[model samples]
Target: MFKKNKRISLLNYWTSRYLLTLFVGLAIISFISAAWIRHTTFQNRLEMMEFLADETVYRLTDTSGQNIGPMGSIPGFIGNRDRFTMREIDPILYVVDTEGNIVSSNRPAPPGSAKNVANLLDGEEGTKKITVTNEGQESVQYVVKKKLENNNKVVGWVLVLEKKENLTRVNQAYGQLALLIGALAVLGWCAIYSLSKRLAHPIKQVAEAAKQVQEGNYTFDLPQNNKEEEIYELVTSFKEMANKLEQLEKTRTELLAGVTHELKTPVTSISGLLQAVKDGVVRGQDASEFIQMALVETTKMKTMVGDLLAFNQFAVDAIPVKVENINVNQLIRDAVAQWEVMQDDETVKIQMDFLVKSVDVQADVVRTQQIVTNLLTNAKQAMQGGIVTITLMEKEDAVLINVSDTGRGIAQEEQAFIFERFYRGENKKYAVRGLGLGLSLSKMMAQSIGGDLRLIDSNSSGTCFEITLKKATTL
Candidate 1:
């Protein structure tokens, strides 16, 4: 037979946990309240008994060592029904002499009650409860005895007896009250469980979405129209995280395809050129030119591979830079000069517009040089014979360098993703064949040195890349 298994939800779990603690706490309070009520009733009964016994002593004798009427007449006045009625059950009274002889009695004395009184008269005052059974019904009675004195000398005794049923009735009342409180507690727990269900509803949605996410599902809905701020924020954050993860997955797929295609072209070129030279199909001068071409392609491949490795390090924050104060203008000039020397096409003119003769900045010299080299190379490669302007100036508390090229600008749609890893724009003139990590890596390098690199402007006229570095403090 197939059996149904019940699933315990978040609400059930929280309810059980909360109610367990509440049950224990309320049980303790009920126990303490019951105990205190019983104790107070017992104390009140004992005090009343003592008060009645004292009144009897006063009525029996005056201060001049003389009886009011006779010794036997004491009980008649002490046991009078009109005088005291603090308890529903009346107490039994007995008057005795100092030598343990009974002088007056309210009722026929039971042997146990008399023995206890005799013990009390004979200096035995420690005993508190005395059990008396009458007509096959057993009951507990509190014993209270007071010394009767005249002229500060012991004359006789007055013993008062009250039943324990009065305190028992009080205890029964408290028990009823405790039952009512327990009912209220049950209602309160029900309310709490309902509230917990409401609270766990949104949380449950998020948990289910996350489970789906673990299984490679990133598309889901989280309603945020009408909800508490905290809950809204939680749902919003989870949605944003899912979107980011989806985008990252797409980027990874693109990178794999792009990297493969980029690497294959140069490798295929070099292989074809070498194969041609090896087979002796090409002559000496042409073979030498083919070899040079292969070398250039290999160099391009090396540069792409290096960029990939450096980007990986930058992603993990593992690339360390030696930070120091350096002359910004000189660094830019040196990078441009080196780039110009590497270029075979002298048709591309390089122009410098230095608004400041010397601009100092805090940066890692080598990495800063790398950033400048990337920009210069990008500008040179983007154009066939146009001017590449390198402008350096001071902007408030920072040094700014703008690299502009008179080539086809990056597409408006692709502008947002230009600095994204493995992202390539479709600008035909500016589309250099390589892994698109240079701008991303350059941006990371700039940020690592407490500086920034960004696309200032890119239009049909030209494209401009700006670099900002904090000014070095003068000692």
Candidate 2:
């Protein structure tokens, strides 16, 4: 019957809350504006009263230079029977001898101060705004009083009595205006809620669809068909994610087949080499050659196993580094030396520049060396037996260890997911073969030690990997 008003629904709740706030806010503003206008009108009335009070002054004195009109008329109530019309409302007029005596009142003054009202003109007068309260009543009145003058000396006052009823009427008028303002505010809020719900409905649908998409359903589409730029971008990003998922599925299938093939090659070689030896088909030289062939196959098997271990570690990754102060320059040199041992001097060259004075870094030395070694290996992998330059320096609060190579660098297409597991780069001439775990392990190791590794520069010359770490200043 009444929409149940269960105190919640996006529309009902938000609109209700907004309406409450709007009503309070508009009520205050409307009350203030209405009150101000009423007050300004009241003040104008006072100014008019002031003007009238100032103008009405006549003298009453005796033979020493006294005029007698004060005896004939009482201030602005010049005629004895003059009736007050609302058009000219102002000071009440009265006159008496210097001795207090009742003379005239436009209306009978309130009884409480009737006597005082009769004689108030006798005193010296300036314009005095006075409040009158009677003995047993709560209602009050304002009297604006000015002196009646005899040749510029005040002989009497012209007094005006305005009742509390007039102020009550002004307040009632303001109250009515406030009610109207409240109604208008409620109506305005309803309109806003209706319009905003229409505008926001599409967004809510998109949000639900996005959640569904995140949970592996890429079949969702935004219902909004208009040119809303942000929603359009959202839809585009979702479509992109869907496409990426499709490509990943295809890559996953290919990887499975490739890995099986890779495994079979080594297994087949090992089985054949062992069987040949067992069948006594070889003598001294042949046996040794077959034995080396089996050993190489076993080595490839070991490499594949290591890649699987690194992949598993990445999945549940551990940051098992004991932080200690180590010489940054020395660590780089050591990793470079290891690579130098693995290659002939004529085959490839290693260059080093230690930029800073001796500085210590909080790092796991083994992992740090591994990261540098992996980057150098990768740099060598991309080149034709060229020079790999490694640098270490302190920058402000961080230590930057850089490895740059001069070789055929990574393709722009391949650089993005270079850190992802099993992302083996394309190699030519079969020299740069790997199970594709080196960069991923290095990245994980770098992050574990509160550091980061990133490719800062690359072009026709090989890519540079910058490993940034907080300099261990105290150690």
Whose lDDT is greatest here? 1
Spell out the clash pairs found in candidate 1.
Answer: none
Candidate 2 residue-wise lDDT, 1-475, digit = tens: 5676454455665777777788788878886888686777677666665554454332223344656455445445444434332453444554443544545565555565656675455465544444554675555555566655566555455665565356324656676786888688768887979866865676667677777767867677665465768766766776676656654654565666667767788999999998999899886899999999999989988888877776677568643577677877777777777767876556667888896588877788888878877887677667778887878877888899888888877777667667766666565214544556788788888888888899887777667889997788672
- After best superposition, candidate 1 residue 196: deviation in angstroms? 3.0
lDDT of 1 at 168: 45
Question: Which regions of candidate 2 are displaced past 4 Å?
Answer: 1-16, 34-41, 58-70, 73-116, 119-138, 151-155, 171-209, 215-264, 276-284, 314-319, 344-346, 425-433
Candidate 2, number of clashes: 3
Looking at candidate 1, what is the lDDT of residue 397? 89
Listed per model in order, the count of residue pairs whose N, CA or C atoms clash below 3 Å is: 0, 3
Question: Could you tell me which 10 consecutive residues in candidate 1 have the lowest summed lDDT?
Answer: 70-79
Task: List candidate 1 stretches off by more than 4 Å.
Answer: 1-8, 54-67, 73-79, 82-90, 103-108, 122-141, 147-155, 163-169, 214-217, 225-232, 260-302, 312-364, 371-420, 423-434, 439-475
The lDDT, on a scale of 0 to 1, for candidate 1 is: 0.79
